[model samples]
Target: MPAFPRHVSRKNEYRILSAMLLLLHLAVWWDFGSSKSRSLLLAHAGVFLIWQPFWRLEKRFGLKDTVLFSLVSIGLACWIFFCWFVVLIGLMSGFPGYRRSGRLVYMPILFFLVSDLLIGCVPHIFHVKALPPAVTTMFQYGLLAVPAWVFIVRPHPGGGASLYSVDLLRAISASMMTGMLAVASIAITYHLGVDYPVALFQSLLGLALFLFIISWLLSPRMGFIGLAQLWERSLMNIGTPFEQWLAELAKLADQQQSPEQFFEVSFN
Candidate 1:
């Protein structure tokens, strides 16, 4: 079977690392006071930290049937950091039986119903604005939900025709961690008297860099098939020399050799 080569040159690796560091430095000095600049920086870092790694992992593992990992990664990162409601909607829609005939059609309707109730009716009961801040946020996330279904519902790429549970779990776990850290950082910064925009930008950039480092360290040292072969050779089979010794012992046993002969054969 053909596989994408895992051969990345040292020079290329160094270049990528250097560029990332440069971007980090530039982001550090960017005017975080401006909402536009902060958003732009977050988007850039999201592409680098989430999109790039996800694409590489998808290619390396051959995990998905569609070319939508990029969209999935972007949507997931945005939802984790900015939109909790979208994640809830995804979890609600991603269960195993939801993909059955007649059910898939209703998932979106259910999502919209719940969203509208939360954004419209609940606020009406509270006598708040008809369109509150939370509703606007949910509306924004509802747009993001379109791309997320591709990630949650796609079949596995390899022979196993199921969802890529490992990849999905990893992504979700990392997203949750990133979200928690970002919130903690922002809260701590707020307590320390840092401005909201700067605190947010700094916290997000720090979380991205931390995730990058963790992924770099935890990435496989060898190709998946190569690692499998290594495991088979080192674990399943003893060695050529041991196989030869076993062959000799079998010969001795077949020949009706005496105990003395078996001992000689075993020692030699």
Candidate 2:
């Protein structure tokens, strides 16, 4: 067997992180009766699971495939949520009238959830090469905000529509700000609780604050530039050969033209 490279080891580290996140999510769901908490945890698991495949796809097939998969995954998630909403409505409406409707609603969400989990496992399933630093970091950090926002802020009371806006820059800023607030609030809560470990709370606070600052500084710019570059690179990868061939053909055309004539004449 061939020796495993250092990069493969690093990729495995991400895989381990993803697995731990999944386990934590399931544990929380099992222990908590809070529907909001469970939904938040599920969203976190969904986004975290996506990062592995997003990175691996980008490295292997390039940015276009990565973006395509991300979009499709998100679309499926939206469909799943919609289906869940319909089921909840049907169940609340009651009885045989809504029985078939409820079943229909339940099936799609279950499918999407399973598909999302499998997609998340893609990094471990396929042994692709490591991506460039910018590509890796941008995808990882950009996606990190998804679960953070969904879990900590969006489903919470007074989370605001601004947090879920489609504007990329605004969304990135809101994610960072809300994440910081969540951390600050958690730290204060721990401090006020006599039984809680102050040292651990402080350490978590410091880490969260550090990440908040970094995201605030980096995310919007990276989101714009990185996505633009990714798209540009994808297009270039597809276009460069054709462009060269056109250039060569132009050269051939020019060479075949006589200096005295502006246009080439052919005898048939």
Candidate 3:
């Protein structure tokens, strides 16, 4: 198949992913039997038919998948959603499709999965109050806002999916850091003797300091190599490591029969 531009290829995937996310968010938020929740559930199932990665993109579903999809859809349409549905969601997410997508593409999905577990499921097991309105608003609206900005406002390169690529290390550390901060603040409030709000304030202050440290590390200006430079070295052509250059040269060597041809191909 001919290669299409990144934006062209990924645009539909983005829409499909966004639809699934929006439905899941609404299903988790709305009350049972509300908004003809049965219809909402059915629509959610239909979107997943396209979003699922079980089969080839253009291939028709086999008998087994057809039966399973129909049965699951009927069952879900009968008002079987919320925490239990989220468990099903968490399981379905393990289908190895989105997990293999780009880090930027999957991070939002991961966050929502965590949200369903934390906000939707945990309360059923433990006594928990509704999230602060500000927090809830941020999660709800922030999801919509980011996608809109990406799709409508931000200009994506034909060669790249986003303005910049996210490294796996930074993504992993950011997720871990968020969880640690939340846990530490709560622990401080409960065990270390302080008000919850007070603990939160302290965490915010620490976060600001952390941001300053990160800023400095990005462009330290201290003769030492900055972290950002090291991170970006893998991307830009000029400063890629010698091992990568050697590997590319080897590939070019194999492809071209003559030294003159090899030099010509390498220069291109």
Candidate 4:
């Protein structure tokens, strides 16, 4: 009946959730031991604060629209810098107001593919030292699951269940599939052997390129479809004169005496 949950007041909920997120980010920064990882966690935190449903500090503090927008934009940029794939999974998982698919059964399959083809698989491809099995597992699932829980599981102020039971099942399935793939890839690569930094450079470089291309394709303004269309048009000979010729051809086809004549005129 109430717009917001009567059980927990909005301000209290925001404070509690924000505190939990801050603690979790710090724990991750301590555990991951990477500057980029810490930056990524900060970005996720930024998105969480400005994400509307999860928190209301913006409205409570009387923040301007431009300020809020800037926060969200910066958060997004940080995610892009850290791992574009995680950003994609967050988008695919859900947001506060938008409706997504009923079942993302294929998401797990996609995760394994991306990890194999783009992430962990690269190290193996180049015979890199690769992370320890435990570390690799953490990177594969723990790293990704945190963001999924935040963006996909956490409910907004007025929003209902972030995911149905079935949706949770799909996320679980994806995680399991990724775990299996990581194990298999590591086993195969371990037997083949690595050449230290030589392989590391190769893997990291290839992965960087892969992420860049994927990020460009996923861009809202100029995605792969836009790029493809531009490429096609560039190679096409169509111009004003070509358009006029096509119009005249259509006119001649309309005036044809029969279907056969129409075909002949169009071909000519």
Candidate 1, residues 109-225, lDDT tens digits: the string is 344434433342233233333344564555645534433442244332231112213235433554465446445544755477664445645766777898776555545663355
Candidates sorted by lDDT, descending order? 3, 4, 1, 2
lDDT of 3 by residue, 127-205 (tens): 3344566875676566565344323332233322332333445445545555555565566666767755567568768
lDDT of 1 at 82: 40
lDDT for model 1: 0.42
| Candidates 1 and 2 compared by TM-score, better number | 1
For lDDT, candidate 2 versus 3, the one ahead is 3
Candidate that would win on lDDT: 3
- Which lDDT tens digits does candidate 2 get at residues 81-109? 32333332232222122234333432332
Using TM-score as the measure, name the better of candidate 1 and candidate 3. Answer: 3
For every candidate structure, what is the RMSD over all alpha carbons to the true structure, in angstroms? Answer: 20.4, 20.8, 11.8, 16.9
Q: How does each model score on lDDT?
A: 0.42, 0.39, 0.55, 0.45
Give the lDDT of residue 75 in candidate 1: 47
Please tell me which predicted candidate would have the highest TM-score against the true structure. 3
Ranking by TM-score: 3, 4, 1, 2
Q: What is the lDDT of residue 194 in candidate 2?
A: 27
In model 4, pairs of residues that clash are 108-174
Please report, as a residue range, the 10-residue window in candidate 3 with the lowest summed lDDT: 154-163
